[model samples]
Target: MLGAALVAKKASELGLQVKPWVKTSLAPGSGVVTKYLLKSGLQKYFDQQGDLDETVASAIAENDIVAAAVLSGNRNFEGRVHPLTRANYLASPPLVVAYALAGTVDIDFDKEPIGTGKDGKSVVQSSVLPDMFKSTYESITKGNPTWNELSVPDSKLYSWDPNSTYIHDPPYFKGMTMDPPGAKRVKDAYCLLNFGDSITTDHISPAGSIHKDSPAANTFLSVGWIRKDFNSYGSRRGNDEVMARGTFANIRIVNKLLNGEVGPKTVHIPTGEKLYVFDAATRYKADGHDTIVLAGAEYGSGSSRDWAAKGPMLLGVKAVIAKSFERIHRSNLVGMGIVPLCFKAGEDADTLGLTGHERYTIDLPSSISEIKPGQDVTVTTDNGKSFTCTVRFDTEVELEYFNHGGILHYVIRNLSKQ
Candidate 1:
């Protein structure tokens, strides 16, 4: 209303009218915004400029629970609005208004009469909103919006399916810790993946088609899946095991461990064997070993993927050393109880002469809770070489999250306190 009123006010002051070529609609975040306009008599300003409310109208009996809702805002795709609804529809504001006016999907809007007026053309008490809608907005004072009168969804929480494969309860909620675990170290950790610059979360955990010869594919095959039934990894992300196997499995990713191999290949330095990334990590775990990841500049630089960090944590990766990090992935790494480290100024993998075979030991302060952003850390190699690097923790809270074995445990601990 404000925008339209401004344009209308300018046109009227200049003794001109708005061109019909322009079109406009009001779709505020809250319905109470309409009440503000109406109470302030701003509704008339819009009307004077030929701007109708064009509000979507619908009738509902008592105790109606919305099974699904499609809005005019950006982001409308299959299973985008609600997972359980099974179907969703996207429409423009004007189309929403028309649908609400029609009120019934069974009646074709093009062929059926919407309704008859009171004078044989309509009996719009049900359609025009007899009292509740008008007075609700009118009850507020003009130009003085109040939160007490804002319309909100009656329900308290979003209903979720516990059995859903796409989105289920995140494991972080299972075991939470308010008082996180104490300070820890990255002990005898081998490098899980070694990559060049610009490794995105997608490269870390791809949701696209699982490759035929990929570890994920082999896992599926082991479970009796045919070649035709091997779906995308993204669809199975809710399951940690599948996603963990899919991590670092992007076909486009080139692991430096394989000396220019363009896939999830990695060398098991202890066993002196070449294997898939997931297989190597599993073998390392069975042998009671932890792992770390190594990357060049701008590591994890795309698409704030939670799984980029989550997958590595699940794969027994205890730390990540990179030249730099994209903001969210770094936080994600910390949130998952994995250490994020950065090389000292003017030092990186090549400069440090990291050959992807050296054993790594990350030293920590006595008190993990006191670890702050940009704190110094000592990364010592198996050959008795040590170098100082900056720990990438942004706050004591993040370190606390790490100590709690990721933020989920921290959240659970806090909730238990309440």
Candidate 2:
């Protein structure tokens, strides 16, 4: 915090300011911290950078040009910050100010000036107290007016509002059964998506802004919600209808099925129709056909977002066949009852001579008890091509979870027996 104050002081003295293109703002931890900064006579300097509400209101418009975000926070993963910020960097608070002033990360403070001086010439140059803390701590337990004003119902069992678009009961266990359904193979499955290397969870999951015409946004609009009122996929996660329609909906996804075109689109194998990934998956489900994803190495590499797994399961993805898988996401796929398979070493879709336009069949054991972790499974394509994949169960517990259709079903059935 002191670093930010010093930067502000130095920038003011040099007549340098944050770039207008760069969105500048401060989200301090609490009002008390702001109060202390105010008491220290540094708030005025901070205000010069426009630390207000509007700058952080919503994500910037999507563009082909690369955008970046430098933050003092630790979670600087790919899509965690904002959809438009393709690259995220971690820096000290003062360094954040430096980058913000420069409006770009491509600079060296040792030789380059952060910004041009007031005369439009390039230049190169490079907090808390404890006293009022007691009073702030006294009221910390009581939330602010908005939080306190929330009307929570008083009941043992929570009432689910059927009309709510924000929060609704998920359908994971809607038709669950106590008895296991014994293992079955995925036969005649269509390739829903064909992806290449480094396909992160960000690419697989629904995230960031809800596009104006996205399926999630349409679902909201159908129920009387306006475009601006449709919060992000992260906010509407409680509603399965919205999330299921958003699977594989990343704006930047590159499906090989589209032949180098970007965005969340795929070829519906049966009809040769180019549809959104979710729309293709829905049509496959309606036609009583299971679907599988084909991908290259390091698939599911980014954040271990549960929605990445949950959304695929809801989309009727029976299996995912890739050259390799990220450890946590592999486990998550099993927990959601979607089989994760890896191609044999040195073999991928490119080498196996298989295009994504083939009908696939995964030959699994007849019963759950016969399946073992890391066992070799045979996958065949309709074009007379076949390959071997390593089943990614990894443990007996995971096998049981898949046997019961998902981890939630496994837990619920066990609890009922008790």
Candidate 3:
């Protein structure tokens, strides 16, 4: 709610009209925060006359883009993205509204454009973002304000109960036996990869249209969902059953050397047979064999969607040996109990001559304390080819998330218990 109000306030101040779709009830903190900000003269530039929905609808009608500024942890507006929006840039709320009003990502601070205000005045876009952030931060952190005083009630905010049955629980291993030392080694090592550049999260977990005639569409159809019922991949994230099937379903993917088989890359070991990406994954999982994914630089870029990591977890990918990783995806990988190992300096998927044929083993323990960032882990294939890669757990927070099995699990165990 604070985020919404901030966007509304920013839009009004910039003379850009807003029409908000009030999806959830506004919380007391939102009203309190907004009213306090307004009383403190932070929102004085924004006009206070319009209704939220009307402003949002008007803005959407008038503008070419409809972007959402959502927090990563909040699930309230999870399924809000529609087919109409051209580009959905997800970031913190202030950034979303600022980017929307500016109408472009390439905003030049030195020569910013000015929008005409309703009061027959010129308003500069440059002043909108920085000022709002500064004031909002100060009001929320330093100023002690009540929700009722600000006209925001608790009933207006969306409520997310951590105990909700819809959320998946972390995997439990109450009576499982641990693998004995040296028993986890694999003989054949095949590097399943492609020579590519700039593999963003959109490529990993596409947010665009899913054609019903495609391989992924056929899989969905096989599972009883009709073409029209096939929603965007982003909408079906909560269900791992659907996510695993849909991961790597992006049509733009081209496994150049894999006999032109696109989408997810598939490789057969020993017999040297080939199959669809997901089918191969299912085969490996069925045989109780571990798998790894090798890729070029910037392997996971774009939106901070957690499903990118979760999809690989469901597919039985033990690790992603990438030349580089985007910030959020790296954390998301660890959150899902997957190892994200980076190639040694000046070495990559291409240099190693990985043929995606070797069986691989990751010695990650189910326990968190046993793993440390920057530790060298050995990788050996069936043909006796071996290499040691450095493990990275860059932050303590990431380690904690990994230790607890993921963010959702951590939240449920900590906050929900209270």
Predicted structure with the largest lDDT when compared to the true one: 2
TM-score of 1: 0.60
Candidate 2: where are CA atoms >4 Å away?
Answer: 5-17, 24-63, 75-79, 115-127, 131-155
What is the TM-score of candidate 2?
Answer: 0.85
lDDT of 3 by residue, 192-271 (tens): 44535566665666354455554556766886777667765656555455566666656446564475654455556544
The candidate with the higher lDDT, 1 or 3, is: 1
RMSD of each: 15.8, 5.3, 11.1
Rank candidates by TM-score, best first: 2, 1, 3
- After best superposition, candidate 3 residue 188: deviation in angstroms? 6.4
Instruction: List model 1 lDDT by residue over 1-418, tens digit each.
Output: 3433333434454555333322233446556556555544445544532221223111111222233333465643222332222224566643433333443333565686433212211222222343546766675455445665666677896555665545555555554334666767778888878878888776786565666788877877887879677666767877776788888876557788889966567899888788888899999999989899888888887678888888888889998899899999999998888888999878888888897798899888767656777789899999887888899888877877777788878787777789
- Who wins the TM-score comparison? 2
Which 10 consecutive positions of candidate 3 have the poorest summed lDDT? 176-185
Candidate 2 C-alpha error for residue 1, in Å = 3.7
lDDT of each: 0.67, 0.82, 0.56
- Flag regions of model 1 displaced more than 4 Å: 1-179
CA shift of 301, model 3, Å: 1.4
